[model samples]
Target: MRLTVNGSILLTELPLLERPAAVRAAGFDAIELWWPFASSTPDQADVDALVQALADAGVQLTGLNFNAGDMPGGDRGLVSWPERESDFLANLDVVTQIGERTGCRAFNALYGNRQPDADPVAQDSLGARNLAAAAAAVARIDGIVLVEPVSGMDAYPLKTAADTVAVIDRVASEHGATNLGLLLDVYHLAVNGDDVDAAIAAYRYRVAHVQIADAPGRDQPGTGDLPIERWLGDLASGGYAGWVGLEYKPAMPASQTDPFAWVPRERRTAH
Candidate 1:
């Protein structure tokens, strides 16, 4: 299992650009992030700084999200939003440059929430088109675009493996997009009351990336009753030889908690 620390969620104590070195110090050679900039298309210098930070830390960027507008403010994503098509497209270009510089091939596209005024069908259709475009962009670098079933946001539409995979299939059929796939996030699936085992068994091959956090509280493995180790074992046995992102919050402050005590020291590094 190649474990990539999710710098965006994990090292909240440090500045965004400094988390990669913290991740490396925590024994991971790889890290992932949500869009780290405030704007969808940030200045070239800002992009260059992030790339340089990763290089200095000696951590490979495994995955990154396309600009998913205001995540802290409850905006889940823009791919499915009707009014944000231009933002999504511009973000795709930035993602391509970041991927090219860092070798981060997997990109997670958070399916936006259902707008009260917009028809669900229309939102989904728009999302499919945007995702198809993203798939094509990343495909140039032998990369994949990931769609995940997120939790907590009631309006966020993709709530299960089936829901997300349906969109992937539609993109493939409608736009002939072969590079789009699923990002099977275990915590989100469990929170949404989906059968995690069944999801893995049913769509293991479609899984392009994986993320894990315990249920009840989005913390490390033992902080809750989730069978995280068991599920990871199943994924590996099922032939998911890809990155497993540690996308969890620490139970205590960064200075006080051994956030990664749950994972063995030797297994923390990328394989």
Candidate 2:
């Protein structure tokens, strides 16, 4: 399959060592990783070992996820914290360098929005400014910047696809930038009350990458509410030639984690 599955095993109770075997055992061409560089500096050998893991496991590093600033002593989001905005900028530089080293082409900088107590307009201005800075920084690298949409009903506050699009546009317009883009998360968009086809149709040319988690439970392909194959066909048809990222958590053991087990053989293309 041309799709990429992330070792989001970090978020789960799974041991990090097992993530690679799980990804390989499931037959994915690439694996996604959260931004190890941005979270903190790591030893070069440790970073090298990760690169080697991808090689030994035979999976490419497809994307790195990097979230922006959140407030200390509070739930303040990207738009609120001006104090540690340095961390956000520093993270971008780190991600760009990592992309150069590891061949990851895109990174997700999707930060949350606003403290419940903050004023809305002020938050927008803060987010837009930070995004503008982020756009300028990422444009210096070969890799692209990806912002995700979150759903308010879900748990995180900034879940709307429309909100993310607006933020990217505002940043790009403000900075006269070209590299800012979107990580279209199909499952989250659905959860936030968006139609996949409509969002895909609107943002086809603007998409830097796409990640797919089946809806309802965010599990393997056959168990969700999404019309997985047909929409994937539509994505390929719409000129989104990038890999379809499998970002779901498997409900079963890694042995049972063939994500495409439900995919009909005829529909799955040989990579």
lDDT of 2 by residue, 8-30 (tens): 63224455545665566655556
* Candidate 1: clashing pairs of residues: none
Error of 2 at 149 (Å): 0.7
- Model 1 agreement with the true structure over 126-229: per-residue lDDT tens digits: 99899999999998898899999999999998999999999999999999998988999999999999999999999988989999999889999878988988
Q: Model 2, 222: alpha-carbon shift in Å?
A: 1.5
Stretches of candidate 1 exceeding 4 Å from the true structure: none
What's the lDDT for all of these models?
0.92, 0.66
C-alpha RMSD for every candidate: 0.8, 3.7
By summed lDDT, the worst window of 10 consecutive residues in model 1 runs over 254-263
Instruction: Tell me the spans in candidate 2 whose CA falls farther than 4 Å from its real position.
Output: 9-14, 36-38, 43-45, 67-80, 152-157, 255-260, 263-270
| True lDDT of residue 147, candidate 1 | 95
